[model samples]
Target: MSAEIAEQPAAARRTLERLMPQRESLRELAQGRRRVLLAARGSSDNAAIYGRYLLEVVAEVPTALAAPSVATHYQANLDLSDTVVVSVSQSGSTAEIVQTQQWARACGAATVAITNVDGSPLAQSADVALVTQAGPEVAVPATKTYLTQMVALGVLADALSSGEALAGDLDQVPDAVSRLLQVDVAAAAEALAVADQVVVSGRGLLLGTALETALKMEETCLRPVRGYSYADLRHGPISVVSEGLLAVLVAAAHGPLAEPMADLVRDLHARGARVLGIGGTPTFAELCDLHLPGPDLSEAVEPIASIVPAQLMIEQMARRLGLDPDNPRGLSKVTQTEFAG
Candidate 1:
């Protein structure tokens, strides 16, 4: 897992280089698309969350996260002719995801499959495939594949939007991720070593990061971690904040949303919860009992970089708890649901 994490910089660079030649085709597909829909499960779904933010904000295209069961179970025959449906899966063989892509293609939508496997069902089913060159991810808990998926989504957003600024930001992601991977988070891991539960919260794009982090911790460390957006946390969940609870807040420093995140951190701290801030301005650092090193990038692009530290923390926590992250109990590398393609 560590080696796979370290390879992300090169993996991202290679993915961008490989996708460059296909940019024109992707742009052509995006030309008249009325909306974008993404489908996936587990960590891939988290990547889709980041993609939703990118397509809406960067490409200025309305985007929705698809509920595959609507098509697979309920048999909804909605028209998707003017939509671009993207199916994300590491193995590319996930039944629901493949079924979603197939259904989208059947509806005359331009379908794209983002996967690591080249000849998987999803790749064959889509009109175009954006394969993540992360290589063989042997771990049951996806590390490199998740990061590479985000990078692939960024490349796709860049292709669709034709934004030079976003293109440059994508180029810097590899280095920023590398720098984040090198940060020493041993202290933070040790701090949370004894905690049985944690609350991971973030705003905007990092909300996906929070979800992914909580998932990783639960899968690897056998800990109960619940993730929530700050707004959702404040809606009612803040009542759970108490002396024994550990809250990890992932926020972006250079955005309008930063102030609210900082305020939440302060609120959590005042509520007798130990707040661990992942990103924000100096005020956030001051309010947080502990702060993890985070990438200094726009919130849209920061998800790719910010998630690295959280993954590292989970890996460290798994090691400290004497659990095998590569092969977590009761989980497989590729889950085969009853709905096969």
Candidate 2:
């Protein structure tokens, strides 16, 4: 698992190298599309959230994360004409995801499969396949595959926006991730080592990062963790958050979101909550009991960089907790679910 974590930088770089050549074509898939529906499960779903923010904000296109069961179980016939359905999966073999891509195509939507495996079932089904080629992810919890998928989505967004948002500079991400791989998070992971629960929060794009962080912790460390947007975390979850609660805030997207996140840190501190800030913003980092400062990058690409440190921290936590992250007890690398039409 740790080896895969270390491979993230090179894996992301390779994904960029492969996808950039196809950017014109990838963007063309969404060209003239009225809306986008992203479908995935687990870590890829979290990456889909990152993609959702990028598509809506950067590409200026309306996007929604797909609820596969709505089509599969509820049987609502959605007219997806002129829409794009992007399915993200590590193996590209998830039954529901492949089926969703197929049904969306049948329903008149352009289809895309972003998967690590080339020519997998989902790839075979989509109009264009953005294969990560990140190689086999042996660990149950995803590290490299998730990062590569986000890179693929970013490439598509860059294409759609005519290189405005990302500015044809997605290549910087791999080095940024490489820098984050060296930061020490052993102290933070150790401090929270005994805690039974952990919570992560962020606003806007990093909300996806927060959620992914929580999921990684739960998957590899075998602890109870939940993530929510900055506001939603306060709505009800804050009621139980008193002293000694480990609260991780993803506020280092290097934009307007950082100040408000610092405010959340103060609020949590006032309640005696122990805070861990993820990002490089000085104001926010100063307030946290622990801080993981990833490379400062455009908000569009920060998730790819920032999440690396958290993945490393999870590896450390697994070691401390004396558990094997690569083979978490109740989880499988790919989860399969299908429904008959």
Candidate 3:
């Protein structure tokens, strides 16, 4: 890691402490019997998927993750009734998500923003702004910022459902995140390099994480990767299972699908596919390797912890493929739509 990333945890810790949404704000939203609607795009959208899961399961509230355009363009489906709209963005200036937040507020929803930028427009527009302490995201592809977004979102969910008791635990997350990055993800990378095809599978909250992981692999490793639900993986995705195939599983902290997921891993291994488990206390088969460890967070929050290993794996995979992760082809840090006049 460079000096830049080496100090990310400290900066993130400060941001988490200083700029998180006030507990009172979140408690008020939860106490009011409101649902949550998460609006975002790209990786921020993916983070909202996990956040939605946390809100539903932990907070015991109804939640949804909507594409920003869905609210901005498809207004008919938008619901503002007793709803808390959370707009997540790294820049807090993305045109689509920011516009969606405006629409939500105009429609009478309590608006919150989780962003890296402190006083950017989206944050300023929100009724409650939660700043992720990720500092500046220099990489064209998001890494730490996405992780901290989840941290901020997850805490907000806890506060929304369980109150200060649950939200207070967020203070320990920076230390946990720092320790997670210390794991050697090289093993997973080594396994990925030789494989011809890869499938990433998960359930519940981690299912969205599985999708994000697949997208990252596609973006960084330039490989054919797909995300699937644990049960769904057994249907048609297993047809490709073979000696050269790799199946990566994201088994999260707590969920009803854990045992079935374990069965899928075992079945995949039996069919000659290499299995790699990424979760807490993975039980990989004799032929498989596991990359596991991090704080015991809910399944919704495990993806945040898992992102460190995922990035390391991709970094090494990109290096092996003779591609610079710092600069991927046909991609740029910021993208503006054509003819925006």
Please say which candidate is ahead in TM-score: 1 or 3: 1
Q: Show model 1 residue runs off by greater than 4 Å.
A: 162-165, 339-341
Residue 320 displacement (Å), model 2: 0.3
RMSD of each: 1.6, 1.9, 2.7
Error of 3 at 68 (Å): 2.9
- In order, the Cα lDDT scores of the candidates are 0.84, 0.85, 0.73
Superposed Cα deviation of residue 106, candidate 3 (Å): 2.3
Query: How close is every model to the real structure, measured as TM-score?
Result: 0.96, 0.96, 0.88
Q: What is the lDDT of residue 22 in candidate 1?
A: 76
Candidate 3: tens digits of C-alpha lDDT, residues 10-127? 7557766765557678777555646888987777777888888778877888998866656667765555768888999889888778888888887778888999898999999898
15-67, model 2: which lDDT tens digit per residue?
Answer: 98888888778676776787889999999999999999988888878899999
Ranking by lDDT: 2, 1, 3
Of the candidates shown, which would achieve the greatest lDDT relative to the real structure?
Answer: 2
User: Which residue pairs in model 1 clash with each other?
Assistant: none
TM-score of 2: 0.96
